[model samples]
Target: PKSTPAPDRHRPSSAPPAAPAAARVLWKRGDTGRDVRELQARLRQVEWLVDGPTGTYDDLTERAVSGFQGKRGLPRTGRTDTVTWQRLLGMSHEPGKWDLYLMGGQPAAAPDLRCTSGRVLCVSKSSRTLRWMIDGRTVSTMSVRFGSQYTPTREGVFQVYWKSRHHVSTLYDSAMPYAMFFSGGQAVHYSYDFAARGYAGASHGCVNVRDEAAIADLYAQVKTGD
Candidate 1:
């Protein structure tokens, strides 16, 4: 579970969907993932859309894509081709969890069975909430943001293997404070981006906690293992 550079999942470490490559990845209507979410975010930034960034490329997203393409003199395919993505990227910036979930819908997945007993960091995706539970009793709860659709936070039970009070990402040089590593590069950490943007941005693969004080408390309570 310990890591240096390989485990860090910062978006900059890998090419964004809009990055140039020989084989292009196109996002069309019905496609669902972080890429699509990003496309919608960009459309919203350029004022071509104000509907849903539901992480799904629905008809509204399609129309937005087409409209953007047409405005930029590209083909109105309603598909986010590489050229279109690149163009949009030039016009807009990346989005966060709150930005993607602009309407502020909570996640819907329940905690794993492992969380019911023993000390556990209960993360419920369905409600986008994390519960710090000790012996099946809830100690504290806070809103959380997992990774983006592209690099999703993992599921299943994992123990905290390491902890760092202050960690800076090797690849992206982003600061991750109070990081409690449960999986390789992925940890429950305090993200400045999450705090600043709210849900407007997302994590690479880490569980991002916005409340610094809350995460500091949780970090103190959570040891290397239960």
Candidate 2:
């Protein structure tokens, strides 16, 4: 009888992180392929990478993935395994509520949304709350989870860059990233399932609201700096 050949040390170019064979190969040092390209595109959406086309896992991609891994409190192996690959693809297994903790309570004072013309409204993931101002009056309120720790909304001052009533996603099942980018890959949009815990926190760092009215209101009133 002939013995079976050894599994390919190299990973295929199109395997998802959840594939059973993902554990058999090292993806970082491996050559680039369609799989790597997919990863590049997804990473770009979340602002984890700035360069590298969809194809190979080049040095730049490796570095970017490494940095991401480090930031996520994972091993800095740089090699793409099932766990790392899942995160890169935004398909990470849900971490239960116990895994997450809030060190500080919600902001003691509400956020100031008044005259936010030239300022950005930042939401604290740690606090699961949002702060904005209008007419010099502060409005600090709790917000639903739009993404998970793995695919969190970015932090920065972004303009109301774009708007859309009907959006689509190639990776996810629904449309999001609707309007306004506030920095660090975060956005404000519409979705009603924000209360579902881990399952609801699946956006690619985009803030999801409760309905069309909310998004519409934001889209019309918000300006480049507001």
Candidate 3:
């Protein structure tokens, strides 16, 4: 009898089976429910759902979804699929019932203690709002965005050190119109991406104001060393 063949040491062991993909409920036009409402709310947070969450997946919702997918290099199906939902969720906060349904009135967030003073740009990450305050009175307030975890917006008291109209970031190659620099490279500026994508995206290390009119007004009022 022939001797048994030696074990092949160079042979690779069998790999483990791939994990199954999570089963996700696909949402398309005409879909209506809490889930759809949540999706709409998340989209609104990112500024995609400009009209707010309607619970029903209508034409507007479909368009918003398609736009978002296109921007993110998704399938552009204009429908909520697993990949789309996951990407949206990662960039957005959990949708509260009020955020989803708009059943309750939205109240203005109280200014931070540090913001109660002379002319100041009161940026509140908690409420995602920025209040232009003068003598402790709010001149104007608008929705704002902050940088991501890797490039967080600096907190605490800071004065406007510089002002630039129609500025662009040399580091990131992004437009930063109406920029009021407070802390180093970080500034309070108008972000077109924020207006377009909403909370779905973040800045490098700046306070992003979405309302162009509000930022323009603020920029006009703000002075260097203010």
Candidate with top lDDT is 3
Count of clashes, each model: 15, 15, 5
Question: What RMSD does each model have against the real structure?
Answer: 22.0, 19.2, 14.1
lDDT of 2 at 163: 58
**In order, what lDDT does every prediction score?**
0.82, 0.56, 0.83
For candidate 1, the per-residue lDDT at 55 reads 83
Which candidate has the top score in TM-score? 3
lDDT string for model 3 (1-226, tens) is 8999998999876898789785364999999887888888899889897775667899999999999999999778898888899899899999774576342113458998877888878887777778888889999888787889999999888889889998988998988999999999999999888776666678898998877888898899988877
lDDT of 1 at 68: 86
Ranking by TM-score: 3, 1, 2
| Model 2 worst lDDT window (10 residues) | 97-106
Model 3 deviation from the true structure expressed as Cα RMSD, one decimal place: 14.1
Tens digits of lDDT, candidate 2, 19-110: 44434334775576556656665565566766534366877778777878798887777666677777665643332332221111223344
Clashes of 2: 15
What does candidate 1's lDDT look like per residue over 1-226, in tens digits?
A: 9766656555455544665555255887779887777788778899998765768989898888888878888778888878888888899987866677654445545556788788899987767888898877789888788888999999988999999998998867899999998989998999888876666688999999888899999999998885
Candidate 2: segments with Cα more than 4 A from true spot: 1-109, 112-120, 139-142, 183-185, 195-200
Query: How far off is residue 12 in model 1, in Å?
Result: 75
